[model samples]
Target chain A: MIPTLQVFLIVSAALFSAGLLAALSRRHAIFILIGIEMMLAAANLNFIAFWRFNPQSQPPTGVMIAIFSIAIAAAEAAVGLALVIAEF
Target chain B: MSSAAFVLIAILTLAAALAAATLQKLMHATLSFAVALVGVAAFFFLLGAEFVGLVLVFVYIGAVAVLIVFTILLTRRDVGKDRGANWSGALLAVAVFGGLGWAVFKTQSVAIAAPHIRALTVKRIGEALMTSYVWPLQCVGLLLTAALIGALVLVMEEKR
Candidate 1:
């Protein structure tokens, strides 16, 4: 048996907290961006975990949502960093 | 629920987070973040979301991380070592985050249990995207296009 979904949630929480710490503690703007990415990734992990333990009738829908989210995140990061670059 | 894979993921997650937090060099921090992303992708795979896992790696590790590094390189004249964490800030973060974690765990204890995962195939996802989520899909496409246009304008403004 795999570790329960609860364990995954805990791990995600830990990741999020670490990212938060980085965001707060780091002075550099770039490190803050990395922290933001970490938080997003942590959320993505939760989505996948829930999808796995809680099987939907449709099955692939959950994973597809995550995939689409990843794509959107990529686009957002691109535009965000581009703006950061242009700004600084 | 105590599989070896879960243990591996837990270890990877914790280790990567530690690296990202403790590393002084900006480039090293970015690399640690990549490691964490890889660990996250692996977690997705274990959750039976192979498509999601692959996309996580490709979009996040391949595209987004690289773009961020490029931005750092281009924007900053020097990517130096970050001064390590401030003690007061770290303490405050830990306190707030610890409370949040406790709340999440406590709520989960009362919520409905999750069902076993069954369908995680690519075919099912494609069908759902085409059918139930058509509008959202279109919206995302439009958003991406707009973002790209905005990025171009911002960069051009810098050149001027």
Candidate 2:
């Protein structure tokens, strides 16, 4: 059986914390981008978890959001890496 | 959807994430970051979001990770060198995690298992984007184009 929503939330929280640690502790710009991407993935995990656990959901809202969110994150990664290269 | 599988994925994800955050070698840390993303995709699949899982693996691992590795190689720094973790930053991360964990435990959720519904197909998602979410779709495309051009401009060598 699927684990409770709380378990997913806790895992997502841990992922967020790790991402924060990476972003804050690292001096390199690329590390910061990696951290931000990790954090976004954690949030996406939460969206899917919530969508799956909710018994009353009708539309595939979370899936759609995750798709768009992935696109935005990809764009961000491109721009961010370019900035890192330009700055150095 | 077995709890055992979830536990395994959780362990893999957390371990990879910690390694990514704490590893000394920049290259190693970036690789660990890629591994962590894979774990996240696995979680998405476990939760029955197969399409999202595939996209996560495709975009994140295929495009983003390769870009990061190339950036590291192109920078020509002593990537082996390590400043290591900033203690203050680590402390802040710990504090935030503690608070979030407390909040998560406090909240109540009635559903313990995934609900039965029609399988989420890519066609349905396509229809939704074309109909109800067409505006946001167009806007995202516009934003992506802007970001692409802006990035190219930023990295362009200045004229003498």
Residue-level lDDT of model 2, residues B91-155, one tens digit each, is 99999999999998877653365677677777877888898889989999998999999888987
lDDT (10s digit) by residue, model 1, range A19-74 = 87888888887788788888888888877776667645464555666767776777
- Could you give the CAPRI-style class of model 1? medium
State every prediction's TM-score relative to the real structure. 0.90, 0.95
Interface RMSD, model 1, angstroms: 2.6
lDDT score at residue B19, model 1, on the 0-100 scale: 80
Residue pairs with backbone atoms closer than 3 Å in model 1 (clashes): A2-B1
Q: Where does candidate 1 stray beyond 4 Å?
A: A55-61, B108-114
For each candidate, report its DockQ versus the true two-chain complex: 0.61, 0.74
RMSD of each: 2.3, 1.6
- Residue B151 alpha-carbon offset, candidate 2, angstroms: 1.4
Q: Is the docking of candidate 2 incorrect, acceptable, medium or high quality?
A: medium
Q: Which candidate has the top score in DockQ?
A: 2
